[model samples]
Target: MIYRSFLRPILFRLSPEAAHELALDSLSFFLGAAPIRKAVAARHRGWPLGPIKRFGLEFANPIGLAAGFDKNGTAAESLAALGFGFIEVGTVTSEPQSGNEKPRLFRLASDHALINRLGFNNRGAAQLAENVRRRPPDCVLGVNIGKSHRVAIADAIPDYLTSFTAVYDVADYIAINISSPNTPNLRELQRREPLAELLRALQERNDELAKDKSLRQKKPLLVKIAPDLSEADLEAIIEVALNANVAGIIATNTTVSRDNLHASPAEVQACGEGGLSGAPLRSRSNEVISLIHRLTEGGLPIVGVGGVFTAVNAWDKICAGASLVQLYTGFIYEGPNVAKKINQGVADILRREGFKSLDDAIGCSAK
Candidate 1:
């Protein structure tokens, strides 16, 4: 009620990227202040329903702040206080590199969407690993890794491996991102042969790291895939993921397609070429999730995302078969309380439907 009525208007006044920075800055400031963080966390006590254990880690709630929202792990501890079950930080690379040019992020208010060609800009893996180690979040922390902008398709394995090892000590789970549209030839890593090799290498290292730390449990490795894949592509990817014994898959990152939009042609054109997210991405993203769910026969754990903005929207993804849910653009449009609202609203639906637990609700609609 407060966000749409008050906050959105003020945020909408600035450039999308600037507004995003401002929001993060505000959160960081509040989060940095102990009293503020405590007050916010106290006000938004996560569903006392209890922890959700998946991917070998227990989450306080199913709502997570998706990667791209916190690329540096700088605010993980503070953001954790706001009520996320987990925070996936970074699409961090081996070496630091400036992302695409400015004006890369655009807002399509009419569509409640965003188009960003951010290109994995961040402070690099080593820095993030240090940040994660120094101040880990209260909730689960998933580190999202990606290929460096300058790394070639052939050498992408080593590039990602460096990042994986650096953050392995600090991450509860790791998300391998090969789906961002902004990175050149990065999606090629999603091909069966390349993806298989990449996951094989990373998972192998994950095992070694577990032993090195004298820890019984190694961090779960998940793949973040693009939504534009064909059905055949999804099937092949599923086979490879299962063979690699990965923990889960983040069903989508963003889409390059611009078909069927409520925004004017001029407005859409102005946003230019980038991955489209938020309400406009709902149908296609859900279609991808359904395809994966059916092909895998609910075997694979999925974190459904893209275009989720309402409790009904979140519930739809949960019923469609997402073991968990995440949000990026929705957080932008809906404001800070978005996670709590979705969690509360979904809990209400689960009770009304007589679903005892979230796991029972998975694929209920698709079934």
Candidate 2:
């Protein structure tokens, strides 16, 4: 309430990207100390209906800060203190990237949306690993990896492998991102053969690393997909993931489609060539989650992202079949307290709806 009523308007005065950086920088700077993190967490703590166990890891709550917020893994502790059950950082590549031209991020205030073609800008995987190791979050941390902008589609496997190995140890789980619309030819990797090959290669490496490092088990591996996929495309992906023995799937990244927008064509056209995220992404994201859940028969865990601004929105995703939900544009619009409110609300909803646990609510609406 405070942020939207006052701080957001002030932050809104800046360019979208500038506001993002300023907010992130301010939070990290103020909460950088260990004692500060502990104090903040205590103050803003949210009650979860029950601990959520997914992909061989236990999440303190089911609400997580989605990837791209902390692209370099630099502010995990500060972000966690704001009440995210988990934090996913990066869409990191094998090498560092400056990303596309400035003004890459834009706001559609009327529609409560954002359009971004930032192209996975980050300080690269090695740096993210170093930051994570230096200041690990108090909650589960997942690292999302993508193809370096300069890496060709043909050499993507090696590129991803490099990043995969770099953050493998630091991340509690790893999310393979092949869905960002900003990068050229990146979505091509989502095709059946390419997707299968990539997952197989990474899984093989996962095994080798576990044995090589003499760890008890390999890390959980997940894939993030775009919300714009066709049902056939999703079915193909499910087959590939199951065949490759991947751990989970993150449904519905940002969308290229501009359907159901309140923004004028002129206003939207002015912000050309970027993925649209926020309220417009809700239905499609839930649709994908439902289909995947039904197709997989609840065998695979899913991390849902898209249009999650309120507990009702999060609950809709949960009912549709998401095992966990994430926030991005919602975090921007709803402010820092978004996670705490959503978490408590979900817990309340669970008790009201007669669910014994969060797991009972999963896929309940998938008829």
Best by lDDT: 2
lDDT of 2 at 220: 93
Candidate 1 per-residue lDDT, tens place, 1-367, comes to 7888998899899998899888888888868877778888877765657789897789999988899998989888888887888899998999888899998999888888899999998999999989877777889999999999888889999999999998888888899999999999888888999999999999899889899889988788899999999888888899999999999999889999998889889998887888999998898888888888888899989999988988899888988889899999988988888888888888888899999999999988888
Which residue pairs in candidate 1 collide? Answer: 278-307
Local distance difference test, each candidate:
0.89, 0.93
In order of appearance, the predictions have TM-scores of 0.98, 0.99
TM-score of 1: 0.98
Clashes of 1: 1
